[model samples]
Target: MKLPSPLYTTQYGKAYVGDSLELLDCLSDNSVNLVITSPPFALQRQKEYGNKSQEDYVDWLAVFAKKIKRVIKNDGSFVLDLGGAYEKGRPTRSLYNYKILIKFCEDLGFFLAEEFFWFNPSKLPSPIEWVNKRKIRAKDAVNTIWWFSKSEYPKADIKKVLTPYSERMKQLLKNSEKFYTPKKRPSGHDISKEFGNGNGNGGAIPPNLLQISNSESNSKYLRFCKIANIQGHPARFPRQLPEFFIKFLTDPGDVVLDIFAGSNTTGEAAEGHGRKWLAFEKEKDYLAASSFRFLENNKSDSEIQGFYGALLSEKEVEIRSKQSALIFK
Candidate 1:
């Protein structure tokens, strides 16, 4: 089906509603600048979100990866948030989600750039037969975010997103610099000048562990549930998760795509960060959910209280005109 043209463009830009795979097919190679998505997990356990057998799950995910590899620009990056699955009754992990996806992306000629651990402190402890039934707690967290690139070395602006060091670390580095002498130079080395003071952007680079929680019960997820007429997808990720990647990976006006647009959190985050977004959802309920969320968040003035008087009753058909009038006034 023909897709809708991009809606009104601003800092945080437009969202398209459709099937992601089909919409991706319509896009040209090297068209998108960044991609951030949390695909439904392939788990044996029943989930409110979609679930399938291992074979079906990998295959379903791989198909989208193939298209993503094609459309992503050479310098662009794709961040995938995947959670592991457990086998039935074993009380043990069976499948490694990242390992499977890494293999799939490698087969498609995408390079593994980096891996991030999203540490959700609020995660419920997983019940364990060995631990809970007999002794203690087993593994708790399940989610991981993988960074993939189309080339061996994709462009990344590391300095743009650097986090500052803690006070304790700063003191340690200061004390260590006095005794930390430079290694012996080669025979012909020109070791002339002393190094400058170590008080630059002090402390080590930020570790890959990202501490974020699921959206608050009243905000993102609740808003989505109200507009979409469906419960939030069980595996729906928080907006902050995608917001981090989009802001760090792409500049303003860059196009970001989410193939499995459950609740369209990626699109919402992209828009908030001033990037254009394209999202695909096959399920009608999902599409409605995404649209309702997008419109509610990006509502024009005509849809609000000021445009509801009797004088404007019959003139609301021209949405753009009413919006323009509201903007000018």
Candidate 2:
């Protein structure tokens, strides 16, 4: 079968605005170094992007996973961020989306490496059916990130990604340095040691449980959605979240793929971090917003002016310049 074409190379990187499955099929096998994405949640509310039945949702998402498996390098990793769903007006934590995805990946021959929780302490509270109907309280939060690999051994540098120790931790390490010092080595043997005080090293290497706020007011994402005249996708992740993974998992110039690129947070984060990025969004409105945001965030003033000169009439440019100045002020 024929595949899609890669498009639009920028200083930040290249991004394809189209269907994810078709785009993945286009990529060369083992071409991608990392895959990070947050797909649409199977929620009851009306999603700005396409929404389907829960069964269809899982099946549709599986097709993208299959393609991801094809393109990811043998030692590469995949990170999927999913949220749990409720069923029959009850708080069913058992119906986790990650479970189905994990099973699907395992069946498709991907190794299940690790699972992390993006714990949002700022999550909205979900009302309980029993209490609301005159009984108890229901749970609120709903997001999980799953990490998978193409092989048993993946390319991750844990030491390079360690979070630095805090001031108190540094002091403790200083106090305990003598204890960590090695005793006399055997004759002619080269002995070296790596040690720390172990008193809370900058939040313990960023635990699988991540606690981040999800407030969206005045965010660049909201601004881009407004400018593009698109209804914002409800499940957009914070840029910092994906940025951490990009920094920790991949090196500069490595290819990063987000098959279910939702609002393209992974692409934005990858660009900011000097990594090559590929994102796929099926919805046209989302594609437009993602493209505009990616370009706008990465453009310099001179570049923006050049674009204005080429695309806008003199009167329109003057109006736009005034608006831009007003925004900066």
Candidate 3:
């Protein structure tokens, strides 16, 4: 399918500025390998980035989910990140995210592959009334991440996203025969002698819960945005979040997409991992500022200004890694 002209193009992806549903329409059926994104959450108070009220969010999202399902390959996965919200004037939590999971599976034809949770250690104390003032509830720092797939068995490899083994596990691997014994425990699971047999892969399979910090103070994207005097996306996710799923769910050269690309972090992660990517966002400033991700590191401030100026003028800019050349169309 031929897509509309993009606001800018990187070597591996195109960042389009328009309604995501419109961009999603241009994609051929079963074209994308993965769709990983954190759309605007259903929050009580509206954020600068915009969010829907809890009541209207699920139906609002289903419109796009249907198109997303059509574009994703049979073995492809849809990973959604939704933050929890509090009910208005009460300490009670909202179930909008859970409702979305049910609506997508029961109403749409998606399978609930697996559920993951993202715990941001740097997240501030929220719902000030309940957590800070009343001291009745703990800080809500976890976001529910639902992994939906068109097929029961999606294209995923945990080996690609393994976490480093702990020091105790490292020691056990080194002296399995001397320090360990094979025995059946009270839990009724028998431990075999080959339990420590990792074959020197150097990592263990990660758990469903992901612990990643969202601190972006020193990131190049933020630095460039500051230099260019453009406001960086306020709710930018850490690249690690998308990088994990991209590596786990897709092979090199496969297509990955983000329907609501904030700073185009998913696109940047896809580019680094050698995957073709597409990003769609309605905000022009955010989409244009995302071009900073593809810019050459050693570019001068004036060059950065000129590049951003061209994008603001609505000229098509193509970024090539070779000599950090900019090709205008």
Judged by TM-score, which candidate is best? 3
* lDDT of candidate 3 at residue 313, scale 0 to 100: 92
TM-scores for all candidates? Answer: 0.75, 0.76, 0.96
On a 0 to 100 scale, what is the lDDT of residue 25 in model 3? 88
lDDT of 1 by residue, 1-329 (tens): 45555322223544444567778878888988888888777776666666667657777777888888899999999888887666666656656575565576667777888889898877765645544675554655747788999887776766556678777546545654564555558875532223345454543456688888764677644564554344655567778788878877888888888877777788778877768887766564454444334433454434433322311232211123224432212
Model 2, which residues run further than 4 Å from truth? 1-8, 94-98, 127-135, 177-204, 224-231, 295-329
As a TM-score, model 1 comes out at: 0.75
lDDT per residue as tens, model 2, 1-329? 44443333345555455677667777899999999988777776656665655656777777778888889999898888887776656555446476565666667888877778887777766544643554465555647777888998988865545667776556556665544454546774432222333443334366777777788677655654555444676667888788877887889999998877766788878887889887776654454345444444544555544433332221211112212331110
lDDT of 2 at 186: 70
Q: Rate the local accuracy (lDDT) of all candidates.
A: 0.65, 0.66, 0.92
* Cα lDDT, model 1, residue 197: 53
Q: Tally clashes: model 2.
A: 3
- TM-score, cand. 3: 0.96
**lDDT of candidate 2 at residue 259, scale 0 to 100:** 75
